[model samples]
Target: MTQKAKSRQEIAEEFGISAKTLSRWILKEKLQIPQGLISPKDQELIYEKFGKAISK
Candidate 1:
């Protein structure tokens, strides 16, 4: 499956987190956001970490 790249706003909404928090995660290296934009691999990793919480 080809996953689409998502913007910071999209990721924040899908993860149920604030964009500011997402940005902080990126800055802190808690989340590995790729240079320029968020890639599919990055999205998958983020989902693997937070998907369950957001799904509930």
Candidate 2:
């Protein structure tokens, strides 16, 4: 199963947070974020660290 890559903004909105906050979290955790989109692996890591995005 392949997961589509997501943009930082998309992920942040899903998590009910600002992209800036997400950046802070990423920096705090020292996670690597790709240039354009968040890879499936990194997306999973974010989901694990911060629960999956809130259901709309």
Candidate 3:
């Protein structure tokens, strides 16, 4: 089965951050993330750099 792609907002939500903050973080870190749905590889890199989102 194919996995559903995740959007920036979804990722930000997962990280407990706002989409704007995620954008800032990406800029600060100089990550080469594309617009729209995030790829699996980029997702992994994001998690690695920022760590997994904390569950409440």
Candidate 4:
């Protein structure tokens, strides 16, 4: 089975953050988050670690 790939917009929406802010966080925090071609498992991990910051 194949998995669907997520776009930056989708990821941002999932975390309730703007795409620009998400971009900045990637560079500023040096997050393990991948922009394109990310595996579902890894993306979930990134969200688990970084999604909380979006609320603050």
Point to the candidate with the largest TM-score.
3
Error of 4 at 20 (Å): 1.2
Question: Where does candidate 2 clash, by residue pair?
Answer: none
* TM-score between model 3 and native: 0.84
lDDT (10s digit) by residue, model 2, range 1-56 = 22789888988999888999999998899877766788888898888888777745
Q: Is candidate 1 or candidate 3 better by TM-score?
A: 3
Q: Write the per-residue lDDT of candidate 3 for residues 1-56, one digit (tens) a residue.
A: 11567888888998888999998999899999999898888887788899887634
Ranking by TM-score: 3, 2, 1, 4
Off by over 4 Å in 2: none
CA shift at 51, candidate 2, in angstroms?
1.3
Worst 10 residues of 2 by lDDT: 1-10
Please, what are the lDDT tens digits per residue for candidate 4 over residues 1-56? Answer: 11566666666776787888768866786767665755667566556667533422
Superpose all Cα atoms of candidate 4 onto the true structure and report the RMSD in Å to 1 decimal.
Answer: 5.0
Using lDDT as the measure, what is the rank order of every candidate, best first? Answer: 2, 3, 1, 4
- Using all chains and alpha carbons, the TM-scores for the candidates as numbered come to 0.63, 0.83, 0.84, 0.58
The models' CA-based lDDT, in order, is 0.69, 0.84, 0.84, 0.65
List where candidate 1 sits over 4 angstroms from the true fold.
26-29, 52-56
